[model samples]
Each structure stands twice: as C-alpha cells, then as structure tokens.
Target: MKKTLIAVAVMAASGIAFAASNVTLYGVIEEGVVLEKAKHGDTTVDLRSGFDQGSRWGIKGTEDLGNGYSVGFILEQGFNVDSGDEATSGKAFSREAFMYVNGGFGKLGFGRTGALSFAQSNAILTGWAFGTGYGLSSWTSAIGNNFSRMDNVVSYATPVFDGFSVHAMYSNGLTGDSEKWSDNNHYYGIGVKYQANAIRSSLIFEAADNKGTATADTLVSDVLTENQWNALKQTPAWSTVKDDVVKAGTAKKKALYVINYGFEYNLGSWTPMFAYQFAHQNQGRRTHMFGLSAKADVAGGNVMIGARYLFGKDKATKVGASELSVDGDVRAWNIGAAYVYPLSKRTALKAFAGYADSGKEWKNVEAVGYNGYQVYLGMRHSF
Candidate 1:
C-alpha cells in the first residue's frame, strides 16, 4: 500500500509540472512623477517607483516532498526605475527570500517574510499602494514591517480552516547582548482574518523591541542635493530621536505600542473602507491617524479617493513613561483622487493628482514648525 501511495504521488507531481511549473518568474515595474513645494524651499520633480507598491522582479520554485508535504523558495529584487538603480540602496533580496515546508498541520520556513503587524495592517488599505509610507498603517505598522521579515528568522503558519488561520515569526539575534535571549531583538505577531463573501475583517496584535537599526525615512535630501541616489540613512538628529524610541524597547528598556483596525464591504460597484490607527512610544508621547477610502467603477474606469489625519503627542504626556515628549505634536493630512484606465490586459493608463499638508510644532516653539504640499502625475507597466 505504501508503494502504491508513492507511485500515485509521483504521478501527481508530474501532472502538476505539466500544468504549471515547479519554478516561476514574475515582476512589476511602477513609476511616479511627482512635483512638490515645501516650507523648507524645496521644489522639484521626484520621479519615483517602488515607493508605492514597491517595484520588483522575482523567481520562485516549488516541489512536492511527498505525502501531504511540499517545499518552496523565493528570490526577489527591488529597484527604482527612474534612476535605474536598486531600491532602498543596493540591498540584495530585500523583499522576500525564504524556504518553507508544508503539511496538513501547516507550513514552517526560514529567511525573510511578513510580520504580524505588517500582515494585520492590510486590514486598512483601500487596495491603493502604500507609497506614502504607511499612511494607512501609520499607527499599526509604525515600527515598519521589516522587523517582521528580518534576517536570521524562522516562521510558521497554520492551515486555513473556515477562512481562519494563524501565522507567527521569530528572529534569532546573531548579534548584540541578550546572548541569554530567547527572542532578543526578536518580535512576534498574530492575526485573525475572515473572508466569507462580500465582507472582510482583520484583527492583529504584535510586540517587539528590536535592539538594532529600526526603520528610518528615505534620504530625499541626499538624493536631491547630490543629484544622486542614496540609501535613506539616519541623520544625527535622528540619533537623539532613536535614543528616545529605543527607550520603548527592552535592551534600551523601552517599548512602543501600535494598533490598526479597519473593515470593508463590497456593494456591487464599490466598496467603502474606514480605518483607525494609533501609536504610543515610551513615556506617553502618542500619535494617531485615521483614514477613509472608497473605490467605484465609472465609465469603464476605476476611481479612488483617500484622505488621512495624523495627530502627534499633545503638549502633555497622555500615556506611557514621563519626560519623554521631545518635539511636541505634529499633525498632517492628505486628500487625493485617481482615475485608472485599462489600456490592455498587461498595461494600465493612470493619471492621479493630490494635495498633502503637514502641521509641525516644536515643544520649544523656538524651533521651526514644518508644513508642505505636493502634486503628481505618473504611469506604470508590469511584466
């Protein structure tokens, strides 16, 4: 009987190979032409891609190991088409690079992949790109998703049952203290999502206090000033900020908490979405963001509208530790609309424009409060 089962499995693998491949190649190329004017006297056309959905090319392969078991891996490369350079500096395999084994219980893998908070954040996205930097998940994915798919990591996912399942990840700290650590510089997230028909909902929770380089912004100043592309490196001013942030961690003996909650319902030609985001770090400084989004089909095209609100820490500590509020509160908002037409099956013609405003405040008031706006038009293609 065992021999018969083995023969049947080999046949199944062969059949699948003929239908599809044990290997695959896929990719997307996106570009955005943006013009902006800021209070800091910055005006220029920033041609971009990989900023929204991230542009990349990748290859993946899968193989049946045997009875209810399989294995697979992915190698992806991200790049910016405008400058013909690597995305996020020349970080090889920056996206996803992992190998996994599947079975009736679930699947286990190692390498880089998604984090709990990052996964939960999809709860709020309106299907639009995240280009504006976690605008949707401003509160939930605050620490950013990188900590989820970090290097030297292991993960596992349970088999889906009734549209519900769980996923978890752990990163091994090959460096730093906590040599006595079990999940040092490590983080974990668990989320539950349900999809029946026209309704969808997601709830996720995560915690981690990574002790190393946390997420930082892009080096726009470096790129624009030098007229060259440079990885967004953290500035010295950020050093102080980072220090405060670390206090939200364990090694630094600090922690940051964030949450994102959202839902959507399909209504024939449109689906409306609403989300709330919140983040609090160390001794009470807090930030909150909320967004409303909707999609509709009109005259053989798709239309989208999105608006967001951000409120930084109040003039007072509202939550965590004390004596932690430094820069005071920063508020921002953006409103935009886009119309996209399907030129062909693989190509799309899109024209979008939007306005963004930022309200900044310095605890000392002697410092400058920053404000800015932007306008953009762009197109994209994929292969």
Candidate 2:
C-alpha cells in the first residue's frame, strides 16, 4: 500500500514537473499502521495521527535574479496520512510559506521560517533519522528547543566564514499596544559550527522580548481565526496553535529565551553524538534537557540507541485564578533500531521496533496519552 501510494504521488508530481525542471515539488508522506495504547488515568484508542515526522507536501521554485543573486519561494501544506487531515483540521497552507533571496553577500528572507534555535542543534539532536519507532529518542526531545516559523519576519543570514555565521530577525508587532510598553520585538541569534572529515559541532542562542500589550487571556488561548491571524504585521498566533494552551500574565510571556548546544563525532567504524538545550520562560518558569545518541554498523546494517531527559516547571500567579499543578517527573525515553536494505536506487525496505516510556503523572493534562511500546514497518521511494 505504501508503495502504491508513493507511485501515485510520483506520477502526480511528475505531471506537474513535466513542464519545467527548474521548479521542484517534493515532500515526505510517511504513514503506516501505528497502534497506540494509552493506559494511565484512562484507556483509549487513536490508531493514527502524525506525531513523528509531520506529513507534508511542498512546492519550491527558484529564479536567477542576476547580479549574483537568486530569489526563491516555498509554499507548503501539511496533510495527515491517517485521516487525510489538512495541517490542523482545515488549514490550507498549514505547514509553512516563505520567500527569500540568496546571493554572495548573505541571505535575506521574509515570511515564515524556523527560528535560530531550530538551527542551533547538534546533528544527533536534529531528528534527521528519528522517524518510525524512535518516538522518544533524542530527536523527539529536541522539539522543545524549537521556535515558531515566524510570520511577517525580516531575517538576514550572514555568509559563513571559517565555519561560523549568524542570523538576526526583526518582527513588527502591529497589533501590540503602545501604552503597554511593548517595544520592537526583535530577536538575534548567533551560531558557529565546525564540520570536518569525521566530526561536526554547533552552538546557538535565541532570545525574545514580549514588548506586546496583548491580553494574557488571548496569549493563553492566543490563536485567533486564520483570516484575522494573517492581517497583523506579525502575529504570535502563527507559532501557537489554536488548541495549544497558554497561560498569559499581566506582562505576557513576551520576554522569553532559549538556548541549545549540540555536537556529533564520527569515528570511521562508529559514531557518537550529544546535545543539551535550556529554555527560560520569562522570570518564573524554566526547563532544561540533555540528550545523547549514537549507533554503529552491525551485520552490514546501522543500529541506533539514544535517550533524552527533560525537567521543567511552569508558574503563573493570578488574582482569582489558581496556579497550574503537575506532579512526578517530566521525562520520556525511546530506544529503537532500524535496518535498511536497498532494493534499487530509489527503493528500500525499512523495519524498525522501539520502546518509549514517559511520565504517567502528566497523562491527564496532555492530549496524547503517554508511556507505551510501538513497532512499525515502512517502505520509502524517491524519484
């Protein structure tokens, strides 16, 4: 079934690319039988949904703008393989949409893009090969270090020199109130990475000041309608989903910061990797995570074993409202292995099995119940 679907997708994509090769329409549609059993406070069944690799389809185009510069644009839409859901129930362009110009000097971009924190992770923490059963692996834990693909953002990335570079983004919060003292919501981040024949390393930092006078209630349930969302110069809703619960303060969480550090080392016969991330929410709450992963070739196939630990506390004091409560530890672990054998250049067979365990304490608060073991088989084809 996966093969048939891939063939159909390839044919459909080929028809569109038949006209020109300059534009590339490519994406990953990974779906299979995912059996989930949540037995903590309650027992239920939600056979399929995208929690690992997000199901998405994207179209990208680039044009030679001359003068050592080129302009490119990307429009992406996410779909669910299980129920064929679009992004989040009904968003047409839910994944991402952005435009940028690349040249000799640097890269200037506008629209929505991942934050610097996203780029600051180590290869092992990047979740590059973390699909399938490795749900609780280091890659999955790194999701917290991620940032919103900001909207109405003007970003500039400097050319790398000697394995080092930086990026700065400025967002204009048009809806932000003036009397609230929400200044220009600007963010700056810098990362320097060293990659050689056998090793790669990176460090990155991202910081933001709320400077917005938006009400705390909206910030908690901040997501407005999509049409209303797009009107602002740059709205915070782009990052926080409609259902994602937020706790707003009189000052808002406008002033937030996150930092991530990662590294990977390869030793011809085997390789190892490590990463650490820390996030501070305003002046009250904070969370930190550390992950380490590595595997080696055995019996002509690669095997991986990895783990991540996260500890966090959330605090908000209100006049009438009460403080949020959580107990036990906030930690999840996943260990899995996958073996791939090539049938052809673009075809391969993949089989993976994994076991993941998370805190049962927060089960009631979380939508997706925690703690279980999962196994799956997948086939991938590319053209």
Candidate 3:
C-alpha cells in the first residue's frame, strides 16, 4: 500500500510539472512561379520558393515560473521547398535559435536572433505594407547593411511605458569564430519603438567593426572605371598594382555604421508608411535611402504598393597615402505592388510584380547593378 501511494504521488507531481510548460510546432511553406527579365535582356522562368517569405519550420516552448515570469525558446529553420535543401548550407536552424526570459523587468534574450535594426525596420518600416520579401523596401534598406540576424548575441527589451519601448543588443562576434572574445567582427545596436492607437514609429542605430583585408580584386575593380579596369588587366603592372592595393586594405580595418528611422500611420482601411536610412563606412563610403509604401484592404483582401530611392556618394580608395578615385556613386529606384487574398486563416494566395533600375553609375559594380523586372504568383500556408 505504501508503494502504491508513492507511485500516485509521483504521478501527481509529473502532471503538475507538465501543466506549467507548453510547447508548439509551427511552419510556413511558400511556393511560386516567377518570370524574370535581366538587365541585358536575358529572360528566365522558374519555380521558386519563399518569394513572399522564407519557407520555414520551427519549434517553440514556454515554461511559466509563476509571479508573472516565464522562460521561452525558439528554434527555426529555413529551407527551399522546391529543391528540398536547407536555406543556409550545412546549418539546420538558420533563421532563429534563441531563448529568453520575461518578467516585470522586461525581457532578456541570448543566442542567435534578429538584430534590433532588423526588428525595427520590419515593425514600423517597410514590413507594415509590403512584406520584406522581393521589394523596394528591402532593396533600399539593404544599402545600410541591416542584416536580419546576428550570432552570439545578448539582447534586452525594456518594458513598455505609454506605448514606448527600447531595445538593445550586442554581438561579441558574428562569424562564430573559435575565439569569439578576440574576434573583431563585433556588432552593436539600439532602438526605440512607439506603438499607440493609429501610429507606429521607430529609430535604430547600428555599428559593426570588421577586421580583414579587402580582397585585391575588389579594391582594384572598385577603384577603377570599367574601361580602366579592362585596360589595367591587360598591362604587365596589373599584378603589382593589385598586390599594392591588397597591402593597403590590409593596413586598415573597416568600420561600418547606419541609422534607420521609420513611421507608419493607420487610418481604418488604409495605412501609409515611410522609412529612411543613412549608412557610412570608414572607407569614405556613404549612402542615403528613402522609401514609401501603402496598404489597403479591398474585396476581402489586401493590396500593397511601395517605392524606394537610393543614392550614394563617390569615395576614393587610399593606397599607400595616395588616393585612387573610385566613382562609386549610385542612383537606384524600385517600385512594386502585391495583392494577397486569404483563402483561410492560415492560407493565402499572393501575386506581385516589380521593376528596378540600378542606374548607369551602378553598372560598374556587377554586384549592385540589377536593371530587371520580376513577376510572381504564389501561395503561402502557415501552421
């Protein structure tokens, strides 16, 4: 009889423990067909995944500790639904892997997660109207190098006061180096957000310290015009110049910084959003960007339209105390629209089209110039 009673007591304790904890599994799958036209008149049609949003699966759990305190964790992974491959090679949880504690003192988090700037941009900037997918908002904001996530981060969010809150984060090393404490790839960010009845606004500042030499090819290519680059490549002194450029880059580390501001106003069926960003680097590079967007509810669906413009200033690359003129000025614009119709609470059909012009200045940099248009028809399901 004693043994039977002890067993019952143990079972009761188990049940109580289980009641304090909750777990959930969730996922989003998006797939679409896309028609793309390249700058040089090349055209392609293909099936794509995650055009609207990244296809992902995740697990999350929370343990209530009573007294208005709780602990939770999330592990999310992204994948390509069309090819059945992980979004990031060799990584299982690429999107988010973090844990947090919440209470009256606000929330504290650790591990890999979205950066404060990224969160602010999504909450009050472009994401309110057009999702942060393949759109102008994303393109313009990318000039600031506002990465979505950082590794080895410690983050804190203050309790809201009158619809105002503050968030801050620091990453010891973003590259996952073995000696993280000594790694030079450090990131720091802080932001303020205000959300009230009909308006939402945010401002964020971020900085990063990167250590390492800019590649020889990048230095030479960026410092010279297309014709100059082609001519130099054919000269016998090209190798020597390239080596000198590498040495110069190696002598100085790059420091990057950016500031972002966003505002949105909601008026019943219509919402308008505006965002601005300024980015600068120690190498004398600077950029300014502006974005505008709106969303409206019509016919039991929502339609979104957005436009962005970006301009960059020219800077010179210094090699051994001599400045090499780099015509890096860029002017770019993009406009797009999307319509999403809900088939159910967790399912939606979406269609979008956009056009972008990288401008003549950006054509010199193969990585940035993309004069093209794309059209997509897709479906998204969430669970």
Top-scoring candidate (lDDT): 3
TM-score winner = 3
* Candidates sorted on TM-score, descending: 3, 1, 2
Q: Pairing residues by index, what is the TM-score of model 3?
A: 0.80
- Candidate 2's displacement at residue 117, Å, is 3.6
lDDT per residue (tens digit) for residues 1-383 in model 2: 45434544665776843232246666665554544443333433344434444567776667787888888777777787778768644445565667888899888877655565442111112322342234434243322444544445667777777756555665554222222233334455555556656767767676766444233323321344434534432556635542232222344564567777777778876678777778776544467776667767766656666666666754433211222254333554445565665566655555555555555333333222134455555555444
Off by over 4 Å in 2: 1-21, 39-51, 89-91, 119-134, 138-145, 170-188, 210-251, 298-301, 316-324, 327-344, 347-373
lDDT of each: 0.53, 0.52, 0.69
Question: Residue 62 error for model 1, in Å?
Answer: 1.5
Candidate 3: misplaced stretches above 4 Å?
Answer: 1-20, 119-128, 135-144, 180-182, 213-249, 314-326, 364-369
lDDT of 2: 0.52
| Ranking of models by lDDT | 3, 1, 2
Compared with the true structure, what per-residue lDDT tens digits does model 3 show for residues 106-164?
98988887776553212233333664575433542333346566678888988999999
